[model samples]
Target: MGRPTPDYRRYRCTIGGEVYTVHLNPRHGRRLLDLAIATGSELVWATTWEQYANDWIAPRIGLPSLPVIPLTSDPPSEHGEMFKTPHVAAYAGRRPFVWFDDQVWAEDEEYLRVRQGLADFLLIHVDPMRGLTSRHLGMAHEWLTLTGFSQGS
Candidate 1:
């Protein structure tokens, strides 16, 4: 007899045996695209872990394949400090940018401010539990407007 197939509804963590499931907010897709258009900001993917994002996360969230900010070399430390800030600052190269992530900290913001030195940068933090909301989008738009970085600027 063949072995039984495992149930897909829930997953058992190998380390802790804790069960978990995924909940996706479909509205984020439209919201993200709308924000990008409204802010005239190009969307790019920056993640600590890229493989899962490319294989699973992006499609479910309705984001198309985007240029990724490589982060494997300097992964996020257990203390929650971010490693992507420097790379992103270097990649943007004095260009204006707004980064949205759940893990940004005060140190990261200060680092960018000092490193970029006159570049327009906004670091918006989102709650991982709630995901992205309309309010966050509004803030991004406001920042761009305030900074005089509208569309083609």
Candidate 2:
């Protein structure tokens, strides 16, 4: 069966006459927690701009407070490279990890391809409109199972 899409709402926040719409998918949040439980995965929070992930995001999503990766002052690359990539890599060190974000693209893949000493890395880019889905979780579970990283492996 295909993955199910989560229910979401868009809330508009106005700041100094500028408006921004934030998408909130509570179902996706639950799915993320379920995925972590199913895969024996460690979910660490990392974001470039959201300072209230622990305070605001986690509570809304039914997640516990997680370790947040600190951001650096790296500028964006011409190919739209993510500024948080290096910080994530450094934080991961030689450990295997799975990254879920809406911003990763080709440039980010290229950046990861050349990094050495990483055991195994899976970068899943969720569609901002759709949020995280069951398919993504299934893929992560399969990867962990194949790599002998699943729970009780």
Candidate 3:
């Protein structure tokens, strides 16, 4: 399967907003969490580092905490792959959601597998070179529609 929008299939820009300067790294976890919270989407992670990122990790970077869900390593029978996001997403449950990680595209199989089971999906990427665009804004808007995140609510 493809993306919600074919144009946005592979990092295609269409958000039509000012591109913000961002530093690409795992440190932006908090900003991602804030985005998830603002959108009212449940934050899901494939590992513990991602789960409490806001509570313990982002705070050091000066970001706030958020509701997060962490998934455990799949059984050895499942060919344990920590970075395997489809399993991680399945662990997240069927909800209006947004997930982070360098693994967003990596979870295409998972996203496709569960598309019908979901109410909504908001995929975000923070690119230092690209900043934010209409698609990004659209994604955030979609996230907000699926979730309920507002500024400091």
Clashes of each: 0, 0, 10
Candidate 2 structure quality by residue, lDDT tens digits, 25-94? 7665677777778878788888853455776567666778888898978776655568888888888887
Which stretch of 10 consecutive residues in model 1 shows the poorest summed lDDT? Answer: 1-10
Report every candidate's CA lDDT: 0.69, 0.73, 0.47
Quote the lDDT for 30 in model 2: 72
Highest lDDT: give the candidate number: 2
TM-score of 3: 0.45
Better of 2 and 3 by TM-score: 2
Model 3 lDDT per residue over 25-139, tens place: 3434555556555555554434444544454444544455655455556454232223445554565566445544343553454443554355455556535344434456567
Ranking by TM-score: 2, 1, 3
lDDT of 1 by residue, 1-153 (tens): 122223212222222353434445655667778777876778887875455555555676677877777765766544334778777877788878888898888877777776456458888998766666678888888998778777766
- lDDT score at residue 111, model 3, on the 0-100 scale: 47
TM-scores for the candidates: 0.75, 0.80, 0.45
TM-score of 2: 0.80
Model 2 alpha-carbon miss at residue 30, Å: 2.7
User: Ten residues in a row with the worst lDDT in model 2?
Assistant: 1-10
Better of 1 and 3 by TM-score: 1
Best by TM-score: 2
